[model samples]
Target: MSDALVTHQDIALRLAIPLEKAHEPRVNTLIQDSEELIQDAFAEVGRDYRLEVANLLQRRAIIRVIREMVATAVIVGPYSGARSVNSSSGPNSDGLTWDKVPEVSFAGVKLTDAHRRALGLVVGNDFAPSWNFPPATRWPLRGGDN
Candidate 1:
């Protein structure tokens, strides 16, 4: 019942998923499940900038979570052939193979360095201020001008 940080429309647009699928209950559940992680990331931005950080970073985080959920479901779902297999030999070879379920990688679901930078949760190298230097009067000065 609570508001989602990213909408089905947003996910459809960003992830190129069908609108119906993006709006599915399972997708919404995944988004809701990721709320705690998103909130924790937002908390790292500090109180003063929390609003702004959430405004900018929540969509990307939600998209990542949704993608992860879908991937995991697909990898372990019945359609993935994890418990069954088809063989070209004959009916004798058509029995269940009982293949190991693939290990789904969730790296993409976590917040990245770039996301942290955008949210101001992590700072990059600082550049020294040039305010003390006088403005150059000429455009094509030689290297010795300094």
Candidate 2:
């Protein structure tokens, strides 16, 4: 996403860190605020279609950011995508309320607001079950499974 790339690059330039390796926790602060702005924009709109569009874009952005950075930094997920729709249900149905469709969990350290926004820039607000990131006893934050 251009928004994420631009934000990531800005941090890289200001910190004199490589574009690929800049410390993101610091820069993502501004990004999170901007995303909140987008949400606010949706709130002002009168149409459901317009609001849903914004929500889709935000989710895509979150997915992109997480997919890109998770390899090196450690992340936790082998999460499932949304399940197939049920033919019996009407086309507008929310698919099966199946108990085990999406497999999200904490991927590693629960990201701080800084990191969470950064990750959100990747995955939006979509829930993800379970993250398979390597254990980080050294990281100040730890997932509860320990």
Candidate 3:
């Protein structure tokens, strides 16, 4: 009930698990951790978490990789084009723009938010942003409900 964000340590304790449970060779942990992180981020943004969780849970399988690694924020941005390495664009620039996009005011919002924002800017454009966490590290995002 404190007006503060929760940490992964708190969540781990609650599960009677370790902060590294996210890397315990199980897929479900990734999904649950991602879900919890998304929920917590939304809560930070003053969103109705019950509704958001319900919406994301409907497609849980898609986000199942999050437990073992950091879920991306590219999904939260707008798409630009074929999005491949080409002569026209490379290394993070597809020449995208944010027009009518919902502006987010919180930090650590997930990649899904970027996707939604990108869509708001352009209905059919594909946008992706790299959060750039070392893929091999698999740091389970910490803090929520903890």
Candidate 4:
């Protein structure tokens, strides 16, 4: 089993975000979000083996999820702009309107093929099953042994 795994500091370093003690909560949340998906994708892999998987590849996967989450947060967060003046009070026609604002949605993240392979998860094209039985020698082994 691998001894080391991805950490919040590793993610911050990967994304070039300034690491602060105060950011730990948010970072931990992000890691938890990514880990849930990771766990689902790699359900067949034992927890111990998962820790031993390629650290770089796992970190990359986590980084992708983190980036998506950060983008969604920014989009849904408050908008920073100048104070708006009442359009009916002045002759000026310049103003911001929400009539054409597009709907914002945060689609949950999915594990990529690379990420799955790195974490020892089965790929869609690969059909090998994890069976414990020995291979059969012959097809017909019923009544007589001749």
Candidate 3 deviant stretches above 4 angstroms = 1-25, 54-146
lDDT (10s digit) by residue, model 2, range 1-146: 46343364543444422544444653364445444544443354432424444576655654344333332122212332324445545555454433442223233212333434543323344467567777877757677856
lDDT of 4 by residue, 1-146 (tens): 43324455655665544667886676566556656767665565555425534566666655565455443333332332323434665676666534322222233233456556655667785786766788878878778775
**Candidate 4 Cα deviation (angstroms), residue 135:** 30
For candidate 3, write residues 1-146 as lDDT tens digits: 74223334433444433435544333234334455765555566566656543564423422332322232212222232223332354565444433332322123223354543322222234454546666686568678833
Give the best candidate by lDDT.
4
Instruction: Find the 10 residues in a row with the least total lDDT in model 3.
Output: 67-76
Model 3, global lDDT: 0.38
Report the lDDT of model 1 for residue 26: 52
User: lDDT for model 1, on a 0 to 1 scale?
Assistant: 0.49
Which segments of model 2 are wrong by more than 4 Å?
1-23, 47-146
Ordered list by lDDT, greatest first: 4, 1, 2, 3
lDDT (tens digit, per residue) of candidate 1 on 70-94:
4444334334434665767654655
- Give each model's whole-structure lDDT: 0.49, 0.41, 0.38, 0.52
Error of 4 at 9 (Å): 1.7
TM-score of 2: 0.23
- Our tally of clashes for model 2 stands at 23
